[model samples]
Target: MTRNFNYWSQKGVKGPSPSPMFGNILSYFITPRPHLNMQWQKLYGKIYGVYNGNKPVLMVAEPELIKQICVKDFHIFSDRNTNRRIHPILSKHLVVETGDDWKRIRSIVTPTFSSSKMKKMYPMIRQCLDDFIVELDVYAKDKGDVNVKIMYGNYTMDVISRCAFATKTNSHKDPNDPFIINAQKVFAPKVSRALCFMLLPTFVLKAFNMRGIAEESANEFFFNITRHVMKTRSNSQKKYNDFIELLMNAQKSSTNNNTKDVNHYDENDSSEAHHVNEGEEEKQVENKILSSVDKYITEEEILAQSWVFFVAGYETTATTLTFASYELALNQDSQQRLYEEEEKQAENKILSSVDKYITEEEILAQSWVFFVAGYETTATTLTFASYELALNQDSQQRLYEEVMTAVDSKGEIDYDILARLPYLDAVISETLRLHSPAIILIRQASEDYKLGDTGITLKKGQQLEIPIYAVHHNEEFYEKPNDFIPNRFLPENRHNIKPYSYIPFGAGPRNCIGMRFALMEAKLALAQVIKRYRFFRSPNTDVPLLLNKSTILHSPKRINYPFGAGPRNCIGMRFGLMEAKLALAQVIRRYRFFQTPNTDVPLQLNVSLAIRTPKRVIIGIEKRL
Candidate 1:
């Protein structure tokens, strides 16, 4: 039966009219609101409506309403609203699952990303960074400017590939590894899925059985690499303290328990009479054994979780680091400050260490640049921050003073020290506000729930999304919303901001888990870069950055500043920032960055599978001393 209702429209709360055939179809593809989605909210108000011919989906902007739907009444919206047909290609991993399966998977995987585990992976991260620095030194040997974006991407890809997956992607040397190639294919925006198919019901898509690009080869490649590593480790009985080792140990424990359970059941005979004590004893043994075994993870489950980590980590971080270099090239002042901080940090480390010198792990932990999370988002933020700084010198100077004074007094930079610099924090925050990389935080509704005032129920098994861009740019929340202003995020002014008004990482139970990492990276990278270079408007840079609306992450049409935002945001955010800061500091300490007539200030940005510059940022680097 066809269902129709006036719903919220009856109460004068206006929204986009629901269209059965082409419900916001054109807008979904052509204009993805690269910067912000406030225009829609202004036109439609808090409660908006959309229909993909069959399903009625509402876009709610009110924070309280979103909280209620996502948290308070989660049961009704428990199931994910995606096309289950794609499960084969896009495995039902933790990111897409719901209910008991999600609960179980999350429980098993949560420990993998704990603080202790990340600390253990620090050495691996530094190894990748060292390799990256060597590569950079080679490129900069001729004193020729390098494409920072590509360099950073290669660095990040190598780091995550080795650290997360326990495999070598060598994206630095071979850009076309099957693993990388397949990942790009899988994540690439499918025109049908983004437009027509995204709205189609899961049942409808499954009935037709639409197959995505065959991932058999990619899966085989990854699986074999994992299997071989596992076998070798088992054979040697050697243990390396890494994520892969943990997974292997977990798998072994699970297998042993399973074997014991089978043997116990087999031993029990139905016809044999047993005493009450014997039965109780058996039950106690079973309970104890199962309890111990249940804590271990399975091989299949590990592969799925680990592979997702690899795929998600590599692509996002690479894109972010690339964008960050683009920003450093443009914003010389910010770059210079960052470089100065690095020098001071290096000097302080050398002076403080008596006999036992600072190891790579110590460097990684202390260097905030390497710990920040959102690489792409932060890089983009830097790009935009540079643009705004160049455009508004007063704000730039204010930020410089804040960073320099703090570093000068402390002798070395610390996370808490950096946090106290209100202006710098505000500038970073403001940049994020203006150019958030992720536009939509996609999640399947856990269950059915009613939206505010709109009595219509959002049924289970429906895909739900929070329009991050829209929330950040809402004029109702931010004054002169489109214009860049650092003061808006200043201490006194920040109180006016709404609860969910700025969710680059999202909110509620499933917010981006790596927010701290991203922030640390950004702070460190920016600190080092700004210490040496002085950014000025270049002819290559477009006065007003033209955003590429095609890709999932918001990217510039030219090489802009780099940095991304959010929680489950970017794990290597800190690492990317430190790398950027180190590179800038090293170069700027020796040279002055100036825009030649040929320099691309508003350079064209290439928005492909990853964020890139249209061409290498051309600038004249002159020796300072």
Candidate 2:
């Protein structure tokens, strides 16, 4: 029953001691997973080992080693351990696939999230934001304190649904919406806790026929939605610029795929019927059908992709907005600086035109990826920034002044202008250091690799969990690691931040795909908010945040930090951030945020829920004059 997976020490990798029965499981379970990883990094060494269940896990924090593992030698560590095989469809998405399959899909989808493509999606988000602002005003009128998590979550869901699925239902106003209901049902932690993936190898779990993922009927319904959408698109002559259109286009193109050979190969080239021996060519076509990537996207595949988008994009931003608003409510001095300022506009040169679309399976996925990762990650960081600012007014005011001095009106934020607010950038960075929502940069070793000159070698199948939380909080890298100090990220102080130690978005080749998007969004939103409303510490503001025990993935995503890392990092990071910035900017422009008696101070994370989250963010808002 007890085992110590001290493979690191056996291989001469110096690090922390592991317990026999649970290895580091208990440690990770009690504290946040990232914090746990950091603890071992500090107590043992930046390079060490701990057991993940029964498996040996390398807890790497050293920048140089991190650089190598995440970048230079990514080939050997390309696969991730988190695979969902129970679901027939969900498992097919790029997030769950490994090796060449992952590569093929990633390529098909990457272009959809490009700058031009995202510009097309922006209007959808803006439309959702407009509704969100109106909703906020309604809440501000009669509410004691509002639950921002719910508010923003619905807003993001509405936005992603329209842009990614090309289907719309008012998730905020309509609780009975089938899409929202079914979306919540998928990947429910209740099903997972009963039959955990970590308890055994993925294959073994698959062998046993465990239903850790959503049930079959649920997936069937989900599939039907996408199927209907695709059928409608194909039969109709209507044209839309959203993700569905792109996917349908890609799907239609792939229907005629004919692999290139020597001198000639065209997707529509069925001339083999005219030239080649029919029987032999037919047999060869059969092999290719089974071997190569699916020439055409399946309805199930498209639905699965759609589901992933809904799941990933919905909950994240709502939580982030909640935290951002809550923090602003708690820090009045910072809020005051904003009350004295205004907004600004930007030029249209920043926008672009899309040249191509992506595979339907990929189209749905990338659209969701752009929406969710961009929406939630940045929102969460803004939440932490607000929290930190409320508690640390000095930093908050400095940021508010920057926003005030940078922009002149309530219009689009120029990219160049957003870049000018260094203090706003610092606040975002510091907030990421203290909070990062997604935890760790996970990479799996593909082959035996040496750990620098440390004489330690990691064998293939072994996992590396670079604790973003620990690295960000390491005292060696950050003085008073626990404090909220934006100056730590200032231009003069940024160099002191050691290369990998400050990887909120990770480092090297496999860093977050949406890093640029997230930063831009956060900067714009914070600037806009500071230009208008003042954030003050409310009675409900949590002084020292507490994480819940039964968190779905790992510790509470309540704080912020880590958008993941490596070749498999979050793909739609840019979209999420853009939505966040746009929404936050709009929010602050309309009203001032404050705390109320119903707010939960020293906020308690939800113990019963699968995801680690604040129980509630009940913040008050007043209309700005």
Candidate 3:
């Protein structure tokens, strides 16, 4: 234990002092994560060390160092932090996989959120958004305050279910829906449990078989549902375009021929081509496959990926929506401008838009990833957008105008029209900046590596964290970092910003794969919502917004862009943006949103797994005059 505590000191790394068995864990618990991180950076400079129990973590914030770690020297830091003690259901997915395994899974999953796939999946997302509007209508008619968080959660859940598995829950109308209940449980705060996973010895945790961050029942629920979906789909003759089908298709392609291109191009696909290895031969095991050569994913891996997507997409997207709306609500000028733009140019309707073969477990996992990743993040984007628009009315109105100006001569809204709107893009980017869903980007050293020109050396297996929120808020990187300024992201002003300084989804090879999908979903939702309604603060609304104590990250995070950076960036970034734009366009075109007595002035937030989401965002809405 003494040796463990002396690890950082021996290396001559500067950091806050650790005490006893808890190390710096106690300090972490008492101080807000964002504030504490800032203090550490100010005190120890860009690179510092901290202990989570006796395990040392090197915190990196310098852009140059970050660039090297995430891009130039990626091979040495290819994997994110992970706990082997996590349940198999959670450990096998793309988010947790390491080294070659991660590379292979990523290759197989990259195409799943291709622009073409997102385009095809738009209708499914639109249908879900349409349901979302209907749900909002109840409050719009009563002139009552609506809770955007809960509402967006339902909408995102529906989108994931529909788009991922071709299943419909209409969660917006049925809050008690089993899927919603289970998903909520999966994201429910488990601070103590998570702490244990961080502090306890790996052997102790393995002996106890700790489930890590999620509830066993919820994990089982998702697993069982995924399995059932896979079975039902496999037994049927019907061909459907969804995530499960795509994963199945991947399986067929893999099993049929190992020599097939892992990064094969589809003429219909619009996403960037994934890098291909010329002559790497892949070997396949009976149930498990490694890298793109083998081109096979096990049932457990599939299930794990699905679980990650669900948890990843669900809260993150929904949280983005929540904050966007909150900000827009507080700034009615932005909201009105966005609304007018939508009314003048956006079409009357918002547009919305996958297939495959293979094992019941494999099928289920694919379906799960779609639902998990697709649903929450998109919904969260909408929720945050609504919140932001309510706060920053001018930005909202500007976005609305962009939406309106982009409409076709016949006032028809389509993927192309929405995709091209710059202000809408700026508004959503700004929203993500101020309240990025991902608080930090994590990496682990693969070998003994020395800091750039610095005497400090990181031993192999050292845990590293890039303080995303801290960097985003650094005064050096962003002027008035706490202010909600969309102009910083505008095409004209974007060049003023620096690279590796704005990572919401993350950067490098291990960045979020669903980024494009999440952003598209967010932009679509924000466009539609701004067009139809204008969000305003209500009595319940938190005027200044107070951060939750237990949340992992806090403070205002600003960035010039929102879709991550470097080689790993967000694959679904385009799709997520499209979805968000479509939704925003559709909503703002028809309704006006404003603050009601019940709105939470300084929105109350809570941590849901990896996302920091509002408990509720109550705002008044009315049909556009």
Candidate 2 per-residue C-alpha lDDT over 1-625 given as tens digits, one digit per residue, 9 for 90 to 100: 4454656666776765666655656554556554456566767877777676667777777766765665556667666764445655566554555666565554444444555555566666656655666666675554334555556656666766786667776766787888676655653445354436555667887787764545555555555666667767778888777666755665665545634321111111121111111123322432232234433454444554555555544444444444555555655544444322222223212322211223445444443334434433444455554444444444444445445444444444544444434454555555566665556667877788887887777777767777766677778877998765656665666657665566555443333445434444444455555444444445555545544443232222233124554445554455444555445454554455665554455554533212234544555555555
State TM-scores per candidate. 0.69, 0.79, 0.87
Model 1 bad stretches (over 4 Å) = 1-13, 17-20, 71-79, 131-149, 169-172, 189-216, 235-242, 249-296, 318-430, 443-448, 453-463, 483-496, 516-536, 560-625
Please give the TM-score that candidate 1 achieves against the real structure.
0.69
Model 3 ranges with Cα > 4 A deviation: 1-3, 27-31, 258-293, 340-377, 407-412, 549-565, 568-572, 595-604, 607-610
Instruction: Answer with 2 or 3, whichever has the higher lDDT.
Output: 3
TM-score of structure candidate 2: 0.79
Kindly report which residue stretches of model 2 are placed more than 4 angstroms away from their true locations once superposed.
3-9, 12-22, 82-86, 141-144, 191-195, 214-220, 253-304, 330-382, 392-426, 487-496, 507-511, 514-533, 550-561, 594-612
lDDT of 3 by residue, 1-625 (tens): 5448878778788899988887777775565465567788889988888887778888888877877776667778777775562665566566656776666666777777766776777777887888888777777675567777677667667766666645689886677878778887765547788777767877888888776656778778878876776767767888667666677667667555545343422322222111111012111210122233335677776776666666656656666776777777666666656655554554544454312223344444544554555555555566666776766667666666666665556544677556555566666776677766555667778899987997877888888888776777888989998777766775677667676677775655555567656766766677666666666666655544443433333321110014344444444454555666677776665555566565655555443223444545666666555
lDDT, model 3, position 211: 63
Worst 10 residues of 2 by lDDT: 268-277
For model 3, give the 10-residue run with minimal summed lDDT. Answer: 273-282
Our model 2 lands, by Cα RMSD against the true structure, at: 9.7
